[model samples]
Target: MSNAPITEIDIAAFTADPYPDLARMRAAAPITYVPQLGATLLTRRDDIHVQEKRTDVFSSEQPDGLMTLLMGENMMRKDGVAHLAERRILFPAVSPRTVQEHWKPVFETAANRVLDRLAPRGGCDLVTDYAMPVSAEALKAITGLVRMTPAEMDGASQAMIDGCANYAGNADVTRRCHAATALIDHHIDLMLSDPPPRSALAVQMQGGLAMTSIRANIKLVISGGQNEPRDAIAGTIWALLSHPEQLELIRQGMASYADAFAEYARWVSPIGMSPRRVARRDTVGGVTFEPGDRVFLMFGSAGRDEAHFQAADRFDIRRDTQAAISFGAGPHFCAGAAASRCLIAEIALPLAFRRLKNLRLAGDAPFSGWAFRGPTSVPVAWSL
Candidate 1:
């Protein structure tokens, strides 16, 4: 591999809480190779910000990479004109105008519907009862997989996410991921038989994208779209509950719900590390990279990079988060960003607080995963 400094990490520990180790790496070895992860990590914010846009060197077109091998080579795995072509095709469904004019109402309705059901429960795991359903329902509408239940949507998304990040090569994870993708294929076939008018699948079909590409791109949306928002919604709620002072700032109208969402994204960063393959030999951050080496742009760590943010580890809603790369910074920047912002900031966060009186935590809301991190279980209670 490259001549980067070597560091060892306990995968289990890293998954549970990676910031401490990431911080250590940023301080000492900004471009270090982790034997456990089999990749050189770029932990500092500036390095990642500068290098991510250099798709010429650190390419996303990893045909043999985990994401491609597991989820199929979607637009996220392509580069330059090839990537932009698919991105443009997929944009109509997630464009700012589309998200505001069409999907906003749908997302608002979905969030309210879930909250209506949970309003009487007094307490529930917000991750499942609220966040999961809301995210899945929006995804169902967006992806035109209305046939699948919220649970199915969430399950498939989580399985594929786990599979994509299964760098250690776990057979069971791979099997589940394959099963999930197969189910998605079945659903896509049904949708293709008679595509919905305005759904993402229908839009792509009309745009003349190949069937394989259509499937892969839809799966990519589901994998990221469902879980990231689910985690962000629940995690933001958990963050607010845990840090009432910050929540109070929003309550007093000193800060907006959008501020809370932005801060939480920077703090907890639901979608953490993005993997790239070295396309050619290059030096970045004073470290040399060879062609075909695996590199991880640690978005999670970048948000907390001390050089970028003051008191970076703390969850402060009022802090400026303009530098946060939670959505990504390259050609592969999340296409669903508008939809996610609408879902979380406009619909999910505000509605939950408005509808649920005396909202508070019921128990521990533990987060997990390094590659795709978010609160797994957010036990919460509210007045009936």
Candidate 2:
């Protein structure tokens, strides 16, 4: 281990709002090991952008890692050939063309259906009432688990996410995670028995991937797929409503919903930190890391890196966020990116704004979580 200074963080405070702490860390060092997280954090945009691609040294394949242990060894945890092979197989399901041709209509219907139900309410918690169901319905159709209700889909996804990030080894989290995976397995079994024509599960099944791999990958998709889009949908709406000036840019056609979505993701990354395992003795940013060291590529921090972004903390939809690593910079970049873009930018945001007239915050929208961050509840009102 290199002689890098060890950093201590208040776990609770960090979870509540990590930007302040992360800003301090970036200013202090290039790499700092945090005892609470049990991982060395790479908070700088430049370092993460460069080091993330160097998979030879910082590997994703961690057999004993929390993700592998809790959610099964999915492609996100693999490196080089293994990772690429799975990604290739999974590509057809989430490719840009596929997302446009197939999932776009599905997402559109889901968004409209959810909005149809909520539009009459005049006000509702956008998180549970709107974003959650829209995301879950779309994910259910895409994953070929249509048998699952929106609530079930959201619950399972949240449970698995909690389990994967259960760094504290909470028994309840692990139990819930296992229970959720078991439920997903049942759904997979049903789907495989009578596989849907073009769902992700059906596509992967046709690709001749193993049963275990297919199940793990499906669970992986649900874990990130449902929550990320859900978070982004609600979070982006909250951001826009909070920043009327930015929203005016969209209304005036100065900025598109896509621009708002990208900026919000950079401003409050839904998927914050990606964990990696040191594959061997390697030096990054003048700090040496030994084999088996856990590293957290802080996408949240990198997005707001002062060196890369001017007035980084402020949410500016007009700002170009090309340097943001919110979806990651390496080979393990999110496979669901196209789907997310279509869902949030194309369908969800545009539809929500159009359907919900005079949409504005009903109450304080509180956000939490550092690893996977978003508004827990976005209370909003709209003219019926």
- Candidate 1 — worst ten consecutive residues by lDDT sum? 189-198
Q: Compared with the true structure, what per-residue lDDT tens digits does model 1 show for residues 1-384?
A: 889999899988999999999999999999999999999999998899889999999999999998899889999999999999999998988999999999999998888889888898999999999999999999999999889999999999999999999888999999999999999999998888887667899999999999899999999999999999999999999999999999999989899889999999999888899999999999876789999999999999999999989999899998999999999987788899999999999999999999999999999988898898998899888887
Summarize candidate 2's per-residue lDDT along 1-384 as a digit string, tens digits.
Answer: 544578999999999999999999999975999999989999999999999999988889999988798778899989989889989998988999999999899899878888888888899998999899999998998899999999999999999989988999999999999999999999988888877767889888988989889999999999999988999999999999999998999999999999999999999999999988888898777788998898999999999999989999999998989999889888988998999999999999999999899999989989999999999999999786
lDDT of 1 at 220: 97
Model 1 misplaced regions, further than 4 Å:
none
How many residue pairs in model 1 have overlapping backbones?
A: 0
Q: Give stretches of model 2 more than 4 Å off.
A: none
User: Residue 170 in candidate 1 has what lDDT?
Assistant: 93
